[model samples]
Target chain A: MDTCIEKIRTICADLLAKGKVQKVIGFAEGSIPMASRPIAVTSKEDVAKLVFNATCGLNLANYVSDVLPKEGKIAVTAKGCDSRNLVTHMVENQVSRDQLYIIGVPCTGMVDKRKIAALFEDEITDFIEDGDTLTIVSPQKKEKVSKKDVLRHNCRVCTHRNPVVFDVMAAEPVEEQSLDQPFADVDHIAAMDPAARWAHFQELTKNCIRCYACRNACPLCYCPTCFVDESSPQWVGKGQDKTDINTFHFLRAFHCAGRCTDCGACVEACPMGINVRDFTRKLNKDALELFGWEAGLDMEKRPPLDVYSPDDPNDFIK
Target chain B: MNFITIDKKDWTTGIDKSRETYQVFGPVQDENGCQIKPLAPDVHPLMDAGVTVMSPKSVLFPQTQKMLTATLDASIEDHHVMKPVKKDDTPRVVLGIRPYDARAILLVKLNFDNPDYQDPYWCEAYAATTFVGLGVNHPGPCDFSTSTGCGPFSEEGLDVLMADLDDRYLAKILTEKGETWAGACGFDTRADAAESQSLFDILRKEAEKNITSVDTDQLSEKSILDLYEAPFWDDVAFSCINCGTCTFVCPTCWCFDIQDETKHKTAVRFRNWDTCMSPLFTHHASGHNPRGSKVQRVRQRFMHKLKYFVDKYDQGIMCVGCGRCVASCPVNIDIREVCTIMNNYESK
Candidate 1:
């Protein structure tokens, strides 16, 4: 861990001096103990604030599009799943590849904040990491737990142990993890009868206040103009009716069918804790089986719904 | 204009064979009534004229995407990285699209691809997909697009237009893409210019006649702008839960917010769709919200649709009047009723 911290400081100082990047956006040791938050380092003096440990679980890729320097180059670090998001962005034309310097890190997964908080009833004063185990020292008690016990749902099915697209590699690239049981939950839902399925959907959708946190957390939903705002013809209404709620979820699920990467960000971002993952995972399975496609895996491949083959089958249209 | 008549039996085979060359997408049935599914040998029968529970906008702009990725550790060598993805331009076909939806796609093209505004993601998807619009033989419960001047068939962005003329379906080849698609169907009879004109006239008359008797002239862009502070918003928005359902279901709402997700040394930045109806829709990081209340959010939804969009897009009425909101609203707040109320209020 000490060696990793030293390496980060040396590289940041060198990058700033060489003019390779104007700014480096990374995590700094937060003022509060055990809390790691996003920080931007412009000069070598700020390098000492950088830290990477078990508690550093927030995906920093979310900040790059907003903070990265446009004229000069910018440098950022990434973990296995984080690299996939970069690949997804490159695939969707959100940011330019030439303007970025990627430092890929092999991850052993990170802890979920909600789970950690639930475990520690009191506020954590300090935290220490020893290999894969995290020891939390709170004002009242000290607790030690394996990082695997509190891993986020996203890290469980992580396929890309190595950065799919990166410039400079930091740690030794880990082998891809198996995701054979990825759709088990979706399959279980699919096994239910139509009435049961509808009941389940209705129950889940009824809880939707239509905050669109699911939509906002998604990476592929980058439309400058969306259909819900059209007024000339007013395709849909502007009230909180059950039918309207159904339409919102139904359309949202369909729209995300082939494009959803199943990062679980939508589920995590939901304040109501609705099972939005079921819909996305179901669509993911459909896209994989029907179109033989997987989103966020290959940057070169086109989304299944976007392009068509002349020999494409359409026996269902009759 | 080119028209061809195929027996109902031959129609399926012709379309099936023609679809073989293009990636085909159309409506399909799930546990729900209907949705636009990928066209396949087993699912082609799902293309009948029925209102899909969901719109086809997903074919262009998706719900989630990764915009960029980064690493926070500076000493890890290569740090901040930006990677942009390219959109696919493969030719495909959308079969069994209602006239209003076909028109809606055209509107999307106009709004998304304007010189002043360009949405590359939508453009790429639209460019790749050929629209094979199927005219509605029966308008469903919620379809009010015909009243708004969008009807059975539109040449706005169609590759091929198929209209059900009683027993036989008239296949009109509109664009060069449609002509090429028609050529692949092994039917050589070209639709003459006269036939095309007659078809247009018939469609226009039918649409105008079916339109709901609403005085939209009074609800112009000017009137909508003036009504921003009207008490009607409070009355109408009373039932609104600020769930963003209207913006999500409407075929034209298009606001978004960007966020970052980071873990360990890595980070990813992405954009997701947002709606004006939510309290946080216009909330900035500084804790100030532009559209803070239900009334403001609701007002913004209608104002953007009726006034702002039209003001920006040159009389471009963003709403296609699909009435999905009317059917879906839990409070049963029909947009048509709201428009009528607004029209009446302006009159007095």
Candidate 2:
């Protein structure tokens, strides 16, 4: 991990010094333990602030659309998930391909801070990471736990561990996992009856406060004005009503049908700890089964849902 | 003031007896995390539940509160006219609320219960409730309440303060409201106030010593324009996703937006918790938004809490340093670090 960080810093610093890019967007040490914040460095001196770790859960692609200067180029330190979203951005015309540089860090996986936070009664004051071992430290006790046990749910089953697209490589690509059950979680929900599925969704969103953090964290949501905020013909209610909360989640998932990269940023950003990926991952499975399609894999073609075709499935239209 | 020594052995029986007189809300563990929910007939409180996922502000200010309701039927008398919905104001007790959160409630009161006009819902709920605060023996790394004019044992808004003593609970009754609830709970083993006060002092000092304070003294002295126009504003707000997570989880964030929803001949007007992080929070009906960009919106959140609140009432910043925003922010937009930047900034 330290070697990966060193490689990332060197690459980003060179980009800044050579005037190849005006800013480098990457992760930095957070104020708290087991947390890392996305940082933007503009000078070579500031590139030392950059870091790469398992705690960098947020997708750096979420910042590309807003943080990029109108004329100057900006570089992003991307993981496998982030690089895919950047491809989505290029396809959607959110950011031009030429003005962007990707510093691809082939990810092992990010750790789920929420999962680790729940294991202790007191605050996690500090921790030491050594290879596959993570030493969990609290004021009461310090215990060693395997990093594999704490890997984020999305990372555990990620098939795309190598960057699909990048301008510079930060490290050698790692081995990607080929899981026996790709969409097991979604299948569990699908196997349930209609009433049971509805109850499942209701339980998942019952704690939602309508914060919209999930929407803002996804790279696919680049609309000037989201449908939720449109008042002329209001689409959804802004309150905590069960119907309203479900509508917002279902609609947002439908909108991200063919574009979502299964990046897990929505799940990571959700303050309520909602695995909102359940809504979008179901669509990802359907896209694979129905159209033999995967999102952001090809830059030359539009998404299956983004285009109108004679061969497109009409069964769902009814 | 008086002290009540609640024996750990008889704690459950006392709380059960109090349930007859008051609707008790306490922290209970669930699938997601511990939540401050109403106690059911079968469920009991998890007194050791530390720093609930959401603050206890929802006790008084619900996330979505229906303020008024109306009917659009032409046959109805005074149709389209809004009327206050009758709500139950049952006597309630919030068990084990953190002292920092209690302090946050008082800070929020300055807005809802000010000189101009009092919010009926908030004031009424506040008047009907008794706050039983629980002092944190060890504050988390995120808590900086001591520097923000609040501490582990600060008793500004709570009626009673309870300190954990491993084997039992030592509760100090601070106000008349506390005594009433204590009596209802059958917690009558009186302890000496002097000894209890000294113990609380020792625990509070130990907890405060653990917290790393962030300075905001320079904010009150610095000109608002200079801080707003500082070069670091863009850099500070660079990674902000403009999500409402920071404000929604915050204990002191009290911005609300009211909207009317008419469905099937019934019109219900509600005031929902709104965040300055949203672009629409300041959007106008004319399609004009003053704080349209993310940078401007992010600036508004910090300036309001750190500068605007200070200038408005000559009080401290409108933050209790509970660290909910610091912990839950998806992008880690820490207010403590932002305060340090604002405090030491000089305009170019």
Candidate 3:
């Protein structure tokens, strides 16, 4: 652990001195009890402030495009999942590889905030991490839990523990993990009949308030002008009617079919606790089976729908 | 040596050159800042500083347009009264359109003119309008023309291309429509063939400099079909509120819902935008929705953008790479992240 920190610090200092990067986006120690928050460091003086522990789970890659500079280089710390986004951006031409300095972190897994919250009967005041085990100190109690029990779904079946593309490496790369257990919830839901599926959807969207939080948090929905705002032939109503709401949801799902990387940002941002990931996963599965496409995994591959070949399958087409 | 210069002050005279034959619409400042507005002779000054808050789409497709109206009362004789056709035929020019927007208009033409499915409304509007695409001396925050392969010299769907050359605007009339429009301008010195060719070269270079290419190399229709069960969807969809903001804001999200609206004796049919993010979007009349969950809906959104749209249309629907969805989404579910995740998810 000490070696890891030292290597990170050294990389930061060297990158700064070489004038390779104008900014370094990484996690900083959050105030008091909460985990880590995204921080942008510009100078070598702040290199000591960077830290990467089990608690450093927030996907910091989302900030790369947010704080991009017009000129010069930018460095960022990326985990396996975060590396996928960096690669996607490179493939999509949203970011240039020459301008980025990636510091890759080999992660075992990251804990889910909600799962951790549930483990504590009382409010958690502070938490400490010793490797994969987390020691939580709450107002009413303290508990030590295994990382696997509370690991995010994305980390459970992580196929890429090592960064696919990186400028610098911070730790020995970990082997890909395999899940022995079945996704019981997904299986149970998939077994249901069409009528039951409709009931499930009705219950889910009934709580939607039309607050576009999910769209904002997603890293792929980078269009400058979306379709809904067009008035010339006003495609969708701006009102909150049920039919109008349904139209928005269906089209959005269709739009993201092959492109969703399943980071779970949309579900986490939802205040209603709606399991939005289920729909995206189903479509992701379908996209792979039907077209063999996975969105952020490869930088050289064209998006599944960008090109069409006569030999392509048309089973779903009317 | 004589050097003739034309500035903003010369715009009025320039308008006067063809005022008798053409109507012009240009950018004007509104409460929401600059947008394209209807250019009347009286409101010509409004075009000087601001772009219209609304796009030129509104000029062609009005907000409250009546497709057809019907009467259902027994005493009134069950008959329908169709709305009178309103077409703008007097050749009109929309000035100062950024290259990206010109590309958008071009896309509209391609989609609406599908050989399989034709949109009469868009076709009628296209016939009545002649475009005057302006060069982007400065672009807006939402402009992604350079990244999406759209630019000033785009011949896909345009009539006249005008480039801002510091002192005087370089006008390249590509089509006969453009030449006729240019001839009506009555400029003393006609742009020679060499000058026009040079202008095209300059415009192409400018576009190339701004062009940012999205790597669609790994993306294919078959790839999307292969990863339907991948676990990546659950991880990426965690923050989605199931709001249709992404679809509603998307320029290429064309999914719509048709409804019948009634007010007393009149019944009108209306169509509005629909998104795949909402759970209700896939709900069938029989109460069965293929995309009943947030994960399924989120997956559909990406597939449509990266796969399905391209399947139906030969070309990718051409997302202008606008970042509105990144900023406008309330929970900040960035699409860029989702695409990255999709790119990384491995098949079992």
- The parts of candidate 1 lying over 4 Å away from their true place are A1-318, B67-79, B185-210, B221-225, B262-268
* Alpha-carbon TM-score of each model against the true structure: 0.52, 0.98, 0.49
**For all the predictions, what are the DockQ values?**
0.03, 0.83, 0.06
Report how far off residue A197 is in candidate 3 (Å). 47
Top candidate, metric DockQ? 2
Clashing pairs counted in every model: 86, 0, 167
DockQ-based CAPRI category assigned to the predicted complex of candidate 1 = incorrect
Runs with alpha carbons beyond 4 Å of true place in candidate 2: none
Q: What does candidate 2 score on TM?
A: 0.98
Q: Which stretches of candidate 3 lie over 4 Å from their true place?
A: A1-318, B1-8, B13-23, B45-55, B62-64, B78-92, B138-147, B183-188, B203-207, B227-231, B235-249, B322-348
Over the stretch B115-207, how does candidate 3's per-residue lDDT look in tens digits?
777766667766766676665543323334554556445554556666667667666665776666666665434556675666667667765
Chain A only TM-scores, each candidate in turn = 0.82, 0.97, 0.88
Across residues B1-348, which tens digit of lDDT does each residue of candidate 1 receive?
Answer: 467654565666766777667777888755323567567765574555356655676666554455567778898667876555544667777777767777777666676788788877777777778777776554544556754556655555577777766565667777887777766656565556677568756865664554454444455535654578676776566434344556655666656666555669878766666777656567576867787666787778777766666667664467777765654442345677666665566523
Give the winner by TM-score: 1 or 2: 2
Tens digit of lDDT per residue, candidate 2, span A92-171?
A: 88898888999989988888888888788798999777767888899998878888999998899888878899998999
Look at candidate 2 and tell me the lDDT of residue B195.
Answer: 91
Positional deviation of residue B53's Cα in model 2 after best superposition, in angstroms: 1.6
Ranking by TM-score: 2, 1, 3
| Cα RMSD (angstroms) for every candidate in the order listed | 24.1, 1.3, 20.6
Per-residue lDDT of B183 in model 3: 62
